[model samples]
Target: MLQRLKLLEHINPGAAHRNVADSIPPPQLHKMSLPYNKVLVLGATSGIGLAYAEKIVEDGKKAIVVGRRKENLDAFVEKHGKDKAEAITFDITQVGTIPNFVEDITKRHPDLDCVLLNSGIQRGFDFAQPETVDLDVLDLELTTNYIAHVHLTQAFLPHLQKQSKQTALVYTSSGLALVPSVKRLNYCASKAALHHFLLCLREQMKDGPGNVKVIEIFPPAVQTELHDEKHQPDIKNGRQMGMPLDEFTAESWAKLVQGDDQIAVGMADRLFALFENTRQQQFQKMVEMMKGH
Candidate 1:
């Protein structure tokens, strides 16, 4: 017993004095509300992001769409009308400017109750042929998908917390977060990182003073440009693959409105069940055991 304590102390410095329980509560499943009014969705130019932006507007919420493509943003604004939707052109990959970007957005839209980090890219990399892989692509994919979101979360959390009403930080992760896709290895890994990050974020904020809800949408391959051959060489006719865009959008919106913190759509629903039933159980059990130490 003494040796085990010494080992544990060595593994985790100051384990005896530090209380993990105080830092994070034990896992509990609870229905979460999506009562956000003004929502800022990053990467809302096309695909799932754009779909969700449209839904937000349709649901009588103000949608602030941000994307790199000015034309697409303009079109979205024109279609939705200025009263319902607004657009901003910004590339999330420019990580250094995120703090200033957040400051400007919050200043302009003080009532912004939700910020959705949904920018992502899918690419194929063959590690077996190391020379064939493009390190630049890998860096860009990881930066846009994971690192940028981390920075955005850090920048936006304070703003969201200051809001008198409930606020939410939404992430569009992938079903691949749970089940690895061989073709899009880095994409899977990025979403997996995001999935774990959301888990920790939710647990920490569950009982905290902040009325912030961490919501994640796990999407299966919908008919989106993500798998286009132009982007992912290994994938062709990818736009025709998976669920229909409208169908996915409608189903996902229903789930979001139903107050599910972890919204999983289509095939992603099966993976989510597996995660909740197996992995989540084990994770909660581990947390329970840690309370004893």
Candidate 2:
């Protein structure tokens, strides 16, 4: 606990020990229209979600804070003005309720233009201990990390297309999705699936006329309660063990504010480069094989 506290101190807003990596946005991408008026943030009470909420507050923006815990939700609204910080009690793992929940948000806050799907979980697995695998844990990770977001997005997309203002549907997919990790097999697999799903969904929106924009955030190993305390898998971090939360949040927020549709932070660049290179090489080999046939 003390070490975590100290590590955070090293990268506080004005701290000198900030680890800024050169994780640039794709060359063709534009800056995001940030400082949202009324964005709905899923998993607003913890980790990267919490940091992003704080960023919104700093920008004097309003958000509907969604979380599973009533107490935490209450505290956030009370601390920040009730008018600015609204609360919604939602357990996204309850997939059946997502459509209704999306309807409620749209009806209640017509001004809401952005929906940030940042809720996720990471659970480790050992293939050797096959008997120890908990089906409940595996199910929760899959449902929360991927399926829930898909349902929510599908529900809100039509409404977003109808809105006059430009709207965004943001998803936080881990860098692990592109680069596999044996420690959290299901978690990685789910993110990978979600990543691909978003690509297809984005393409569909592009094919038709829609006000909605799709944004994907690929986070590296950011120091968060979930990553540090919960399933601390050995996700390789370059330059530092794990990026300090302040540094990660600042860098990520900048990218979003700049209007980037897709962004990667810290060591996520390594994963992207490796994956793209491998894909290109495989494509070339496949082409050579086709020539022989």
Candidate 3:
């Protein structure tokens, strides 16, 4: 009877590794296909977005970089040359105009296959101090960081979905989603929501024609214009902030070319590993740390 019980246990549905094999999705086979010869990068004025655009052009891919600043866009076009790169002025927060803008872009560049939604803003706030946290500023941050991204994705989805092959939606999220930071409530919330949205979208597209690939980039604090110049001294004293702009770009470009779904840079990669190893413990620790700051 004992021997029979052992045999039954092996056949039970609750057996540990029984469901594991079924749960695994087949690995994507066609990895080398470049979604398109041309790509669109939003928020190309500065920071990681601009850096990425430059890398794309350097790799000999035609990249159209968009930003709100006309002069900055023109400068990028001039520096990169009209053949390899183009620049357009766009404000993603202007939701009403997004559909028209997307239509115009698609008409002009019918071959465009990849869209990178990389525009975002970060602001520190003291929820406890009303004077320090302006409602309008908070609202703007949320709108630009989260709402604009969702709208732009929606506007471009049909175009992306209709593509023949290798189409992708790439988003610039943050490490804050994995671990919370103090005084950045709005930024953290926006990034966390974006991360969840992308994850759900990825799952939904699983059984489809592999028409759309969702990629998320989680970067740690980087040396950029996001912080106030006046607060440079304070930031320097606190901790080692992000890496140099060029260095970060180089690493990010190499990873993207290799077709990584999730790219974590610098110390941010450590946070990713921590979450995978001890999700509950790390989450609690993060909550505790945020409460004190």
Candidate 4:
């Protein structure tokens, strides 16, 4: 545990303050209202997106979950009750179709003010074996993880700005965005791109009368079905290294409602500062050591 903390202490100095259980939202929502009450969660059929939607529903809010599979969407909408949760079966990677899709949603649910860009793909790459690699895979990760979200954001931002109510534009960037992983180079790059994109989006929306708020959730490793069977060994190894999905999501929701603009789950912040500080080199060395181990 000390070893784990050592690698990340530079970024997670406030780790001791992570135990604020009393900060959880009460049954009656006695505190401030969350800006994301009526949110559209992209890639919401599984993993972190689904978890966020479920949490929103549990908080007595509405979530419009967008996914690629109609079957999964149907099942989720059926189980969650149509009132609290709605499903939009659409592939986020289909960036060109998003503008029309957004227009439809704006017409159908004018009250929808938040868009959580949570849909992404995580895939590994080998630079050495360029011939064996499918370069098209790179496109998939970049488009699905970063580019599609940008398209969706652009499509919705204008409408969100016009709304009188508060609006939130949330993003789910990974810990790897800060500290790159050796294997998933493209995935890390995509997430890093998203992190920067969100930063710029926030800056641009700064003078917009506080009606539009941007939030970035930097998540460390968690138990999510983001990877496939080939990545199982790596996933199993990294699974023990992260907080449980339930714990991560619970803390994330509470902190978000508490009005945190940039929320890093558990030890995720520790890694977030790596690129700026000299600790980046130290982190790289640690990564090499881990590979050796």
Candidate 1 on 1-293: residue-level lDDT in tens?
88887898899878856776778977897644348889999999999999999888877889999999999999999998999999999999999999999999999999999998899998999999999899999999999999999999999999888888778999999989988988689989999999999988987777766799999998889999988989876777999999999998888888887878988887889876755558887877876777646
lDDT of each: 0.89, 0.80, 0.81, 0.80
RMSD of each: 18.9, 14.2, 14.3, 15.0
Clashes of 3: 0
Candidate 2 structure quality by residue, lDDT tens digits, 1-293: 76775777776743434445434555785534474577889998888887887777767788788989889878888888876788899999999998899998899888788899999988787878999788899999999999899899889888888877778898898888788788789999999899878766776677455678898888987777665433544443322447888898888888998888767887776766767557646755765677546
Cα RMSD for predicted model 4: 15.0
* Sliding window of 10 residues with minimal summed lDDT for model 4: 272-281
lDDT of 4 by residue, 1-293 (tens): 77777656667775644667766766784664465668888888887888888888877788898988788777878988999888888987777888999999999998898888898877777789788567887898899998888888888888899988788889998877777888889899999889877766776787885478999998888777765545534555454556778888988888898999888875577755544335545744755677535
What is residue 46's positional error in candidate 3, in angstroms? 1.2
Q: Candidate 3's error at 128, in angstroms?
A: 1.1
Off by over 4 Å in 3: 1-35, 230-240, 277-293
10 residues in a row with least lDDT, candidate 3: 231-240
Question: Which residue pairs in model 3 clash with each other?
Answer: none
Give one digit per residue, the lDDT tens place, for model 3 in 1-293: 76665786778834543666787999988634334578899998988888888777876788899999889889989998999989899998888999999999999998889999999887777878788768888888898889999998888888878887878899999888777788788889999899878876776666565488899988888777765444333344333356877887777766777889888888778987866336646655765676546
What are the TM-scores, per candidate, against the unseen true structure?
0.86, 0.79, 0.79, 0.79
lDDT of 2 at 88: 91
Which residue pairs of candidate 4 clash?
A: none
